[model samples]
Target: MFLSTFFVVFLLGVGQAQPEDRSKGLPTSFPVPHTDDMLFYLQRSRNENTVIYDLNRKADGTVDAGNPINVYYIRFARDGKPWPLKWIERKFAYGYSHKKLKNQSGFQIELVAYDERKIELIPS
Candidate 1:
């Protein structure tokens, strides 16, 4: 019984000793962007710049039927301001296309670069 307990404790200790994966090695000092309509953001180890995804809303505060999400970049490495992606970046990197569901439930989003994984956005 004591041997088994010791082995279990050792395993737990080893697990705790492992370093945590910190946002794919993003710098901890980088400031996280925030906005009222922001849904989420993606960061990369390549640079401090961040990609922001925000809900596109109408004047009445409802989700836009045609364009439901706005994707842009927060250029932290530059002046820390939001900027539209260039044509090349939009075509090859972070651009995405979304389609409203036929069932009127939500929008189906597919990344231009990585289309194998689909993201569904449902408004509350």
Candidate 2:
């Protein structure tokens, strides 16, 4: 009886340790459809010691066709700047379908800065 109880408890502990959604911030595995308009990918470039907000454009000439949407890069030394972009991307990107954004033609966005424990996006 004790052996059976121990086995059941062990299985329960193992199940709790692993989550159903096993995903990470970098290196996305799921293939999401590309958008012709402006699409952004925020990546941590360890070599440059900065974060790269890569704006990728589709084949159409609507967005910046010549370059890789070349929007911007940010170098931050703030106390807690490591994971804000990743957190935003993880929250927004997961299971995000672009069908709703099809009607939107253009986007006007802004980034603001604040001091201490606050994070902001910088353009290169």
For each candidate in the order shown, give its overall lDDT on alpha carbons: 0.87, 0.38
Error of 2 at 5 (Å): 54
**lDDT tens digits, residue span 14-104, model 2:** 9889565534333333223233333454433222223343444555634442333333324333332323335454334311211112344
**Best-fitting candidate, scored by lDDT:** 1
How far in Å is the alpha carbon of 16 misplaced in model 2?
Answer: 45
Q: Provide the TM-score for each candidate, comma-separated.
A: 0.71, 0.21
**TM-score quality measure for candidate 2:** 0.21
Angstrom error of the Cα, residue 110, model 1: value is 0.4
Off by more than 4 A, model 2: 1-47, 64-85, 88-106, 112-124
Write candidate 1's Cα lDDT for 1-124 as tens digits.
Answer: 9999999999999988968776785666767898999988888877889999899899998988788888899999889999998898878888889888788689999989899999989867
